[model samples]
Target: MKKEIAAVVFFLKRLIKKAEKLEAEKVDLFVERLTVALQEKFRGHWYTDNPSKGQAFRCIRVNRFHKEDAELLRACVESGVQYTDLGLPKELTLWVDPGQVCCRYGERNLAFTVASFSSDDSDDKEDVTKKVTSAVERVTSDYHSGSSSDEDNGCREPRYITGFSHRPPYQQSLLCHRMAGHVPVFCGDRGDSRRHVVLAQ
Candidate 1:
């Protein structure tokens, strides 16, 4: 588990560093590729694709280690934004250590991920699987429509996120859509039944 976590850390560190050195449009493209790599890692695959050349992050900051889902929530609050989770995210891959997602405004793209923020972090295996499934559904829906979020106002803080059950008594079965306020960007898997939207909070 430690080795797996370390590998993800290395990938993200490299991604942020490279992304910071590129131009705006190129940065967006790199972010897209980075999102792809993250989804692969979240889905339990070995993702080694580097989006750009190895450098240092200037504007984008990928939190080296997201220990738990709650920290994601904290990051969102710190950023002064609201984010949502996918209603179904498990069908892709379950990440032991969370990763970052990219949110695009008119010209800027901020990267982040969601995790458990509530104190009731009672995420069993079944619960987490449901969350993953929920995420997939939300992103698919957004993709069919579009990411209509107003990008200019969202803060620059590195966003972190997590999915939870709004239906408290039934936490194990269903996931809730809490990030309804922001624009959702969908990233897909090349060959799998899993996909999700990256919302900026």
Candidate 2:
């Protein structure tokens, strides 16, 4: 009976050691797989396909080390704008605007403008007037559309205006017609000017 008990204890110890070795090997293999996958997925055009160059893509920022979900955190940071796990099992999703979409990891302070067009119309006097009027109406409507019609409720509609100066003579000619009165124009220092009629309120 003593011999049998000793044999059982030795066998259990060996089994536990083997299990631990296998678990370690499995973890190593998983990390290798994850690294390869991340390299293939998040690899950008900025980096040439030379491993010796040791290039990291510009979009990813590594914050700190995490032992629990190290592989997952690495993958998320490499692919996403920002990621936070906070001791959770999975990473959290972050919101980004259109201007923030194409920025590098450390370029969060950058600002950009995005303008939309209605149709294939040209930027003539009529088009400019329509756009200016539309902008003003939209702003006013958004502010006062849902207000109650009470005389005592002092609500004011918003206005839109643009100023122009120091432009080329020919460019200024295109802005105001000789027969028409003073027309508001959207002038860019680098590009052509757009002319519009400012509606008198």
Q: Weakest 10 consecutive residues, lDDT, candidate 2?
A: 99-108
lDDT of 1 at 147: 39
Candidate 1 residues 67-163, lDDT tens each? Answer: 2234233433443323232111111122333222222221222322322222233435454344434443443454334333332345654343333
Q: Residue-wise lDDT of candidate 2 within 172-200, one digit each (tens)? A: 55653331222333323434353333422
Q: For candidate 2, list the clashing residue pairs, or say none.
A: none
Measured on C-alpha atoms, candidate 2 has an lDDT of 0.30
TM-score of each: 0.22, 0.18
**What local lDDT score does residue 182 receive in model 2, on the 0 to 100 scale?**
28
Most accurate candidate by lDDT = 1
C-alpha lDDT values of all predictions: 0.33, 0.30
